[model samples]
Target chain A: MQYQSQAVAKLYFTAAIGLFAGQILFGLILGLQYVVGDFLFPEIPFNVARMVHTNLLIVWILFGFMGAAYYLVPEEAERELHSPGLAVLMFWVFLVAGALTILGYLLVPYSGLAKMTGNDLLPTMGREFLEQPTITKIGIVIVALAFLYNIGMTILSGRKTVVNLVLLIGLAGLAVLFLFAFYNPDNLVEDKLYWWWVVHLWVEGVWELILGSILAFVLIKTTGVDREVIEKWLYVIIAMTLITGIIGTGHHYYWIGTPEYWQWWGSVFSALEPIPFFMMTVFAFNMVNRRRRNHLNKVAVLWALGTAVMAFLGAGVWGFLHTLSPVNYYTHGSQITAAHGHMAFYGAYAMIVLTIISYAMPMMRGRKAANSNRSQVLEMWSFWLMTVSMVFITLFLTGAGILQVYLQRYSDTPLPFMVVQEKIALFYWMREVAGVVFLAGLVLYIASFFVGSKDPEAAVEQAASPTA
Target chain B: MTRGGSLPETSRYPPGDLAVWIFILAELAVFAIFFAAYAFTRMQHVALFDQYQATLDRNAALFNTLALVTASYFVVRAVTAIREGRTASARNRLWAAVGMGGLFLLVKGMEYAHHLGEGIRLSTNAFYMFYLSLTFFHFMHVILGILVLMVLAMRTAAGHYSAQSHTDIESGASYWHMVDLVWLILFPLVYVMH
Candidate 1:
């Protein structure tokens, strides 16, 4: 169990570092575009870059979940993985598929891929890869299947612990939800209906399951919290998630020509969606406070704590502020949406993924513990840098959205899209600056992974075992 | 195995079950929102909703609901039967419950096919959209519940579950009851309210 966990840990660390780098690179591109229009236009447009950025964020997070699953399931079940060979095979297949998918995005001509994929986003003459969503969808499914099989078989054989059961249901949800990608409905409404099935359900629904499982894994490890205590938290978190999330999708439905009542339904439920995130924050901190020991892997704990705080701010508070029908009536589909997306994903899932990587790295390397005071300090800085920048970005974008909605959406003498676009130029520039700060944070995080310390005192504190 | 010899030994109904219940309850809440949406939307298109409701096979939904309710009852009976060492009775009741759940799904699939033949789809209209999403979602849960029952039945057959080791049965039953509870709401909203 220990050996396999370490192996999975190594895979996770590599993926995390790569993902953090990707995040910063794309963030910089996005940031610069806000300031310098045409910075990479015709060569690497915003649309294509955004696809890679968002999709990579999703992919790498999934990779982290797999790693966490591989590590925890065995330990929780008190057994080895059902098939380590299958696990290894699934990992490489997913990696190769992921690499090819991204490469295919870059290398394939936009027009050709768009034509082949039937994406009607643009003429695709000079566009990057936003037009080529087919390959990406296929890649997602393959990864989902490989992951489902690996984890599914393990749970099928192993003891059905709360951790494993929740993880299994969550993974199963991942698979069922991905089925939406295969079909291409012609009607835009139908198309979006299924899209929400994949998008909203996966993130707000199953992803909550994933978060619960990961949090459970961390609590059991770091605090030696009774499995019972940790497991109960997982349940309550998931319960809160579903209670709000199902209706939360209504937020997206507001402008999608769904019923008018959705405006009310989406707002009310989405306002409640933050409750779980709030609960998650309380759960993480309460467990930490109730800890029997004072040992700290500062980086891992930093990421975990950051997950709670950022999720509250991004998914909870930000989501609620705009989720109301009255407020969203103005802000829907604006850059404000982009701001929320950036912060929420980074805050909730991204940090959780990073936490797993940081937690598992030393264990994977067979280091008794990682003693990287310098890296931990750097990581701590990165968390704040990225978080603070995102808040700035969200603030500016929200301001931009309010202006856009008031002047453009509602006014009789409505400005043209380009006119409003030009008017919001300052906010855009501010976003770009904030993006740079975020990217700098990522740079620090990636560097910290490889160039950290392993001294004994820090190691002992990290692992809570002097011998380790 | 005593840690510091101070804490009591681990109890049977551990935190896992509570956690599972919490999760299950939250899931029910999401479905509640979904059901509420269906009701709210249905109210808006009351004429069309009424027309559509009249078209539905209430008999089918009612039967499905009754079957589910009965199955949930049998699950309780099975739990009691197991407790009293009535293994054969428990097994029979469990199999019957599983069969009824399957029957509900079969009837639902047929009804869905009928609706498809009548040109209803997820986005056919507001009425059909809610109908498909709500019932289909419920159907998926039924399928899941049936799978759980199958596993419990296998375990029961193998004598792997005893009164003390019956958390699996209880959890499965709780989930089945939830499925039934959702049907209780869905039946009136989808088929009977008009």
Candidate 2:
């Protein structure tokens, strides 16, 4: 709102929410396919639906990050964006390319899509999570470059704050590491090794810097805390993130055809991955407690805090549960991995993007500082609804994972994967129910934006100083 | 900014930047979990651990321990010198600490070369995996620690810090001490303890 270019973020956020709905819908379809198996059948198979679900999630979150950067960087730098036009252009390019890719996935078989898209030239398709054809991947790279040029130039030309610097570094790292996704090989081990350079390095590595900077930016605005204090802690937290996370890449190397040494290296470093999340949790609470004045955006504050705790529980705690090689040996590809993936992605990335959107959306829409109180209350309800449902989703998956591990991997006579899955269908059903609740929560979340638009903005009350 | 006044109660203020303390606590947590994993794994394979523990050059580890301890002593002296308004002496002490750190890395590097030359690798055995993993991880910390000390030394020599304003010095020193502290535990657990 402070800068004309900041309005461009509204387009990106609106697109993000739209794709988020698409992601959850596809997620529910995939969840149903888990139990009913033939519900979607040949029309839209589970694998294709899953690809849409996950790809949508990634695309939407990228939109959210781009939107957040567009909104926050100008305010932090105290300048107009270098080229809002480039941002809008790249946004359309990314969205159209993403949509086309999803359509291809639905319309054609994956192999046919690959052949049609000339994936044989690059052959980056068919891998887990990097399933986009080579052409689309190239398009992604081009879009990323333009986006970075726009943001990076703005930050360099304006007041250089730690928040902006960290965010730029994270965004740059994200773009650079993503190049590894293009480096697929016939050597499965080598492919897997570098695949992590993209995946692990993004989520656990640079993306954390993005997450921290955004959290810091929000905390500084909402709590009226000292920027210096938050910025300092930002450096410390991100330093810990890379310190543990860089070597922590070894965790994925284990059980792959990598050397036995990775077992120790991976186990030790990754077990410590939770440290930064724990610090993040503590840092969020401590800053809020030390607030000079409470801002009227209570839901934003709630999200900032919620992101911390849930990230710790979902990414930190659940991750550590199977991070050690011994534990992973039994649980590697089971529902446990799925369990961890669902919650960790939702908690860490999905929630943080939502946090920034929650904070910035109201401002972009001409509110003074916050949405109306009724809107905030409904948003809070949505928060609890979505968050609590996610917790149950994780728990139910964990339950399924534990049972699957026992019956399929550890029993006196180990059962086959399908046989064990049949026994654990009940957990999947419960998980599907939980997924429905999550969708309902998403609906409520969307409703929150429209419910109180015409009402007066929420007012801040000067409560007694809790710290004093 | 002067610490010349009665030092703030430890209850009210931690010694270094609060930010650095948070970093320190995170680092400690990682090391703690690692040590616990080591202990748990060792309990399950006492004979294998003992067999490999014998192969380690305890004398080199003992020497490295002395180097780190002496380096920590030098860091403590540097902190004291800065507090007393002796920037030159503090700089000299930090340089001396850096030298000790260099000695530690040099010795540890030689140890690594010896092992690699012997064709022993991480995949050689479970025992070697833990030994090399833990030691090499700590070794990287030493290198990082030295880099920090070198920065602190340069800053001190340039008169960037004072008795009143030396949080950077304290923060760097705190990190170096942590590196040394982890080694102290690491040396005893992985190298000496039966």
> Which model scores highest in DockQ?
2
User: All candidates' TM-scores?
Assistant: 0.71, 0.94
How close is each model in CA RMSD to the real structure?
A: 7.2, 3.0
- lDDT value, candidate 2, whole model: 0.92
Regions of candidate 2 where Cα sits further than 4 Å from its true position: A461-468, B1-13, B36-63, B191-194
Per-residue CA lDDT of candidate 1, range A150-203, in tens?
A: 777777786788988888888888788877655556677776766787788888
TM-score of 2: 0.94
Q: What residue pairs are clashing in model 2? A: none
Give the alpha carbon lDDT tens digit for every residue of A207-284 in model 2.
Answer: 999999999999999889899899988998899999889999999988889987788778878988998998899999
lDDT of 2 at B124: 82
Question: Which pairs of residues collide in model 1?
Answer: A239-B26
> What is the C-alpha lDDT profile of model 1 across B1-194, one tens digit per residue?
77887887787663225555655665687678777777777777889989877889989988898899999999989888887767777778889999999999999999989999987766667887777777876798899889988888888988977766776677778888888998898898788887
Task: Assess the local accuracy of residue A403 in candidate 2 as a C-alpha lDDT between 0 and 100.
Answer: 96
Local distance difference test values of all predictions, in order: 0.75, 0.92
